[model samples]
Structures are given as C-alpha cells and as structure tokens.
Target: MPRDADATKERILAAATAEFATHGYAGGRVERIASQAKSNVRMIYAYYGGKSSLFDATVAEALRRMAENVPPRPDDLAEWAGDVFDHHQRFPDVLRLSMWAQLERPEATAEPSEAYRDKTLAVATADASPLSPVDVLVFVYAIAQAWQLSPAGLTGLEEATDESETVAARRRSVVIAVERMLQKGP
Candidate 1:
C-alpha cells in the first residue's frame, strides 16, 4: 500500500478500535469511527471493506497487543495472569467489545478463535503439570478471563481500577483452586 493509504488505514482501525471498545459492535458506528479517525465513512469502507471487517481488524489488533504484552511462558503463569489482567484493566472497553462480538457473531470468527485457543493450550501443555492439556488450558484461560470479567463489587475496586489487591486476591484464589484441581486430577 502507498504510504498515505497505509497511514489512513491504520488511523481508521485505531479509531474503530476505540469506538467499538466504547460502544461495542452493536453500538459502534462507522460514522463515529470515521469522524474519530478524521476520515469519512466512504474511506472506512474503501479501506477496510465494511463494519464487520473493521471489527475483525479491531480484534486482531487487540489480540496482537495482548500477545506483545504477554507471550506465553510455561514457568511464568503468575506473571502471565498478571499481564492478562493488566491488559484487560487498561483496556476494559475492549473486553466489553469482545464479549458483545462473541455473543452476537461467534460463528463469524470461530476459526481464528479456535486457532488462538489452541495456541494457548499448547503453551499450557508445555507445563510439566498433572492436569490434562485440555484441563490446563481450560483452567488457565478460565481464571484469566474470569478475573478480567470480574465486577468491581467482586473485586472491591474502582470499576476502572487495574489489578488492585482485591483483584489480585481473586486471581490467587483462582490459581489455588486450579492447582488443587490439578493435584486431584480427574
């Protein structure tokens, strides 16, 4: 792509990401994203094809950022969990957007979702653990996402707070529960 064109596409995606994160897929509007991007609706369509495509880009970018923040490492589950929670805390709106997309159009991106999931599972399998590969993945992601999704009341933190003591306490509980389950192996 040409320099200006590439820059425009990046800006459009950045705008769409923030917009969707704030409003979710149902509430995200191309018009609003375009306005925020300093581009027109036509430009968004021209660059990204359409709203669904833009959503895909937004998710991909979010995931990429996530991967950057916390690449999988077997011995670092605690740190990894912290990174995941921090990412969600810093970008809670993105998580909300993802939940809406997951609910609304799961089939639309099942392939990528499964691929991403499998890769994560592979990371868990690298651990010299007692849990089955599937169980490990399920437990790890379950804990991380649950912690990310925990309400402020459950966490006893400001809704916008990130990785508070309460939140970390919740995570520790998850980790202890999973460790016990692994030790007891089904």
Candidate 2:
C-alpha cells in the first residue's frame, strides 16, 4: 500500500496490541483502538480487513519480535533461562499479551509453529545425552521455558520486588538449579 497507509496500519496494530493485551479479545473494541491510534474505524477495516485479522497480525508481529530476542542455541542452559527472563525484561506487556491471547483463544495452544519445533529439535539433539530424542527435547526446552505466567515468566516476583543485586543473585541461583536439573539424571 501507500506510505501513509502503511504508517496508519502500524499505528493501529500498536494500539490494538495494548488494548487486546489489557482487556482481551472479547472485551476489546475496534472503536477504542481506532481512537487510541488517532484514526477512524474505517481505516482499520481498510488496512486490516477486520478486527480478527488485525488481532492475528498483531500477535504474529509480537511473536516475531520475541523469536528475534532469544538465543539461536542455548549452550549454557542456566544462562539460557536467564536470557529468557532477560528477553522479556522490563516489558511485561509482551507477556501480558501472550497470556491474554492464550486465554482468549485456546486454539493458540495447538497451532503448530514448525520453525519453533525445528529449532527445539536441533537443540535437543545437540545436548549429547543418552536419553531418547523426545525426552531430551522435552527436558531441555522445559528447563529454560520457566513458568509461563506470561512471556516474562514469574510475573509475581518481578512485580513484588524492586531490582537489586541481591534479587538478581537469587534469580541466578534459581535458574542455575533448574539448568542443572535438566543436565543431570534421566
């Protein structure tokens, strides 16, 4: 589309991301998103076809950003766990969007991300473990996946305490323990 149209689309998606993340799909409204975006409702329909399609586009864009944020190969799994938390650091909204998306649309759970599976399979196969491929796959990925309260992981802890060296050290310790568990035993 034209330059103006493209910019308008981006604005709408940004506004919709915040709206849907907060209120979820059922409660989210197109007019409110349009008002926040500073464009009218027709522009959203013109740019994104409809609200559902716009929501999909917003989610796809968020997922794309998150994929770019993580390590291609998590060689040090504890560090990987740290990195996962680090990836979502400060931006709890991304996690909020993910959780809200899952609750609002259960189908998201079964939607196959072939690229995600392939990256995971590669990591599992590389761990140099005696466990079966499937077992290794589940275990290794699970190590760093952390509690999926949202993409941020363990939202309660982050929200409760202010950032400090002591807290950081404790988080490191916990992640290290989790990583070690994945490494040892079957």
Worst 10 residues of 2 by lDDT: 141-150
Which lDDT tens digits does candidate 1 get at residues 16-123? 878887777778899999998888999888877899888877777766666666565556554555556666767776677677668765544453465566556765
TM-score of each: 0.76, 0.75
Q: Give candidate 2 misplaced runs (Cα > 4 Å).
A: 1-3, 108-112, 128-162
The 10 consecutive residues of candidate 1 with the worst lDDT sum are 106-115
Number of clashes found in candidate 1: 0
What does candidate 2's lDDT look like per residue over 1-186, in tens digits? Answer: 445877888899899989988887788899999999999999999888988777777777776666667644545555655666666554556666776777876554334365467656766657744565455444544544444343554555454655566447545754776566666573
What TM-score should be assigned to candidate 1? 0.76
Model 2 lDDT, residue 8, Cα: 86
Predicted structure 2, TM vs. truth: 0.75
lDDT of 1: 0.69
lDDT of each: 0.69, 0.67
Cα deviation at 140, candidate 2, in Å, is: 6.8
Give the CA lDDT, 0 to 100, for residue 39 in model 2.
95
